[model samples]
Target: MGRGQLVRQRVLVPLFGDVRGRVISWSSAGACGFKGTRRGTPFAAQTAAGNAIRTVVDQGMQQAEVMIKGPGLGRDAALRAIRRSGILLSFIRDWKCVESRADSKRLYYGRFILAPLMKGQADTIGIAMRRALLGEIEGTCITRAKSEKIPHEYSTIIGIQESVHEILMNLKEIVLRSNLYGTRNVSICIKGPGHVTAQDIILPPSVEIVDNTQHIANLTEPINLCIELQIERNRGYRIKTPNNFQDGSYPIDAVFMPVRNANHSIHSYVNGNEKQEILFLEIWTNGSLTPKEALHDASRNLID
Candidate 1:
């Protein structure tokens, strides 16, 4: 292996299985050893499990392999805690034992017993619409997510969603087609939308098309479609507070939820230097595209 290749250590805790002597089994590679804690309680389980992983990494470990085998909630949490602490986890193995008896009867559901009746009028709305749309593209570079349809239509949607796995595949496809980033920087100024969707929820679970003047407008200047990724684990971002009905009488059950961000990175290889800088700006508004304005100014500053 290379010098910087990750080294792995395993923190095996049971989710639910046979009775055991201790809460965890602590193992290490550079120096092989094991430690035992006397309590099987959840908190104790996490404490012991975390310490076991810490022991391996504290002695210079880069990655850990986790094997969770139990019916307890704490097992998974402990693994996540360890992962967030900067140790790369390589593998997770679930070792569950099952037993079988010969004296048993098997039964299937009623619908399964009756073979599916495919002769009835099918739901041709989406299919017919798709056929007309497909005809429009006719040999002009069209791809299908799946080869055939299934009885339950939901299965096909998943296959379609897989075609563009990224969050904004539509925008990405257009930028590539325009060759916007090939020679110079490009800026896209979008308007005429009532309210833009959340950055995390921009893409839908279906096959989508991107065409200039129809989906996005083509620009004479170089186009730079930048995607930035950020995440907040607790996700506690908000902008307002709720007021009580009866002159400020308050109860203890009110709460606000935090929003999550997508995992994105803005990378550019301008003329093979591979070190171009990116500037990010965030703006919030009630009824206007405030972020778009800020992005325009920021892009000008960095690339102009």
Candidate 2:
């Protein structure tokens, strides 16, 4: 045969089975003129699979039940081509070589189950899994103190409330710095001092102080408190600051670090009589970023 004719009639598939059984078909890259190492390459395997599938299709074989026996580079490519072909697949099996005690010969060992692929199912599952992991999961943390003095005291009780409001408001944003989700409503409930009353606590339009009762503190005694804040899961946010405090910002490690990668449940309780009073918060989310990773991202964002 001429070189061109021999190349055109290359045997892409060589089927083998029990002597008494009927042979289906098989193919290899080396048979298609790919020499030595090139025969094992993915491209060669893909081409061989494509040609073999086309031949089987022309032969009126509606479905192929394949048993893959070797650990060859072409294994995956061949399987992929089989799926891409219009032919129906009965099943695909992976046969492994395991040494047996009875005979030194290695036996084919492993079970292969038939899994039929439906249109668009893989994409749908991927989208749903991502949404559940990053969006639906929640995490939490609690901060505590006996009497955590205001960062910088203000002249009036209103001033303290406003300062606290701004500080807490910043926290809502810090939680968002992780870039996982945004919070729509930040619920803050302050239970101790009169000056830090619900009405006095002013937050952004999105935040709401769930408790409205006024527990006015007595001048003779120190104020004890349990502040509860809830951050609703949503999306990422922009950190907003007041004009006066434009130049100043909190330390990323001390503030934003705690808010990142903290999607797991966090619970804390400090007795009123105890020397230390506590602040508690719970953040929830499926595993996304680690706290350290979140901190790194937050710091990088600030620099950028």
Candidate 3:
């Protein structure tokens, strides 16, 4: 290990839930392995429980691939736990097998390839995806466009939006990841269910997040931390035009502008230099950062 170099650990937890039973197998960086168990369908309650367990297991692995299986509700929660624990996941797969074939099932193949962690970058965007079918799945955040109004055909959409709430939750994750890479400082703004529970949430050593979900999370306040962002006007420059309201709608692309608090609330593009820049963030509410705070944010570039 070189001086001041940081060592990263990755861990994987197999989640099998709602199959009338469930179990967890864990392995560590240098240690052998450990196993644990929980009873029941591994439904919602089990999912929540499994999330906590996955987090504990993740803390020990330097690199991990979570192979989850079974017909259970907890699979998604397990993934969430892995993300929250700061263990960068290599992939999420369903390793369950089915007995349908006779000859084809006997075929053997060997192909090894290591995929980098880029697509998983979406993990940095954390809003719960609204889904219908209960199958092996990946999640996506709701955009007001496709998600603005629940289609007349689907009554369940209303319930989905209610549980997940609004505003993509993954922005916090995205911002945190950027900060970790010395790209952007975090300025959290969030609010939602289990408000009191937010305070208990944990974060990485250097990541910053605000839990506005009913002000549930206690946040640290630095005397002077400022985040200066350079924004570009869209080709149409109609992102959030307060003046023109003709009732007729324009393609979202037509309003290409990306600004804080534009009509498309949380939709934005973080503009900055190509190389990650180290900067401090001064978080506040009710107004923009003040003059001194702005100066501090602009002047405190750590690397010469």
Candidate 4:
């Protein structure tokens, strides 16, 4: 009923079978006049598949299914050759890695494979999941900063190495995780003759910094530096608004997306007589959220 291709690193072999599991025709890259390194090339595989499919077609076959196995450069090429043969592909299956993991508290990486989907469904699910992960997930970020003596963003403190504006910019790079929602205030009072980092910021009980080593600013002299930060949990980026700032406070642009990157790929497979598709998704995050947690939340958002 369907053809099978066994692909190796150095060669490809296509086998045509009948409904009763009898092999009626078979061809390989080696049999197609390819030699040495050329036998493993995609062009050689395509030629081999084309020859095998042609033999099967001459036997009065109108439709075929393909079962692909192994890792090789010729897999896709062979499939392409089958598609060009004008045979209705009722099924296609490939075996590959389903998942990998490199997860931590602050940085997360995950791979997910969704399979047995009908044609076009993988792309639809992938698009919706990516959007939900990147646009709907909420994260915490510093939205405003207040300094007692520095009245404006351009002002500089005597002992600090960075200007007020520079310090505000550096604060945006800090990654923070919080269980609580809405607005909260956190302050840092550092008497510094050294470097200041995220660890120095005094956070509330419900919040913690993802990376304690993230630099904020440097202080050359032993001067008391007191600063207040207003943090908020929201979704997506928020530009600075004049209405949110008080006299001594300056607004900072906030990025509340915990998921740093998200993308997906579609694959095809077969189950029973149905031609199906699969989705391969990858997500990377700043450790504020785990990939699994982010995927679950994103799917829930799509569902809701």
How high is each candidate's TM-score?
0.23, 0.27, 0.19, 0.65
**Compared to the true structure, candidate 2 yields what TM-score?**
0.27
Higher TM-score: candidate 1 or 4?
4
Taking the tens digit of each residue's C-alpha lDDT, what string does model 4 give over 153-266? 888889899998899999998899997679999998999799999999999989989989988989999988888999999999989986776868888999999999999999
* Candidate lDDT (C-alpha), each: 0.27, 0.36, 0.25, 0.78
Encode model 1's per-residue lDDT on 1-304: one tens digit a residue.
1011111112233221111212222522112222333333445545655656555545565654454433345555566666766766565543222321212111111100111101210122123222322222111111111112222212322312222223222322221111111122122222322222232113222311222222322223333222221111111222222342222211112111110111111223344533332212122211111222222222222211
Model 4 TM-score, all chains together: 0.65
**lDDT of model 1 at position 194:** 24
Lowest summed-lDDT stretch of 10 residues in model 2?
1-10
Give model 4's clash tally. 1
Over the stretch 1-304, how does candidate 2's per-residue lDDT look in tens digits? 1000010011223242221234434456765678765865778868877866665666666655554434445667766786787656555543222221211111111111111212232233224323333333333211111123434322223323344444444333332222223432223344444444344433455433333343223222244443333343333322433332312222111122222222221123334543221111112222233322222223222211
Better TM-score candidate (1, 3) = 1
Candidate 4: list runs displaced more than 4 Å.
1-106, 242-244, 270-273
Summing lDDT over every window of 10 consecutive residues in candidate 4, give the lowest-scoring window. Answer: 2-11
The clash count for each model shown is 12, 27, 17, 1
Of 1 and 2, the candidate ahead on TM-score is 2
Best by lDDT: 4
* lDDT score, candidate 3, position 195: 28
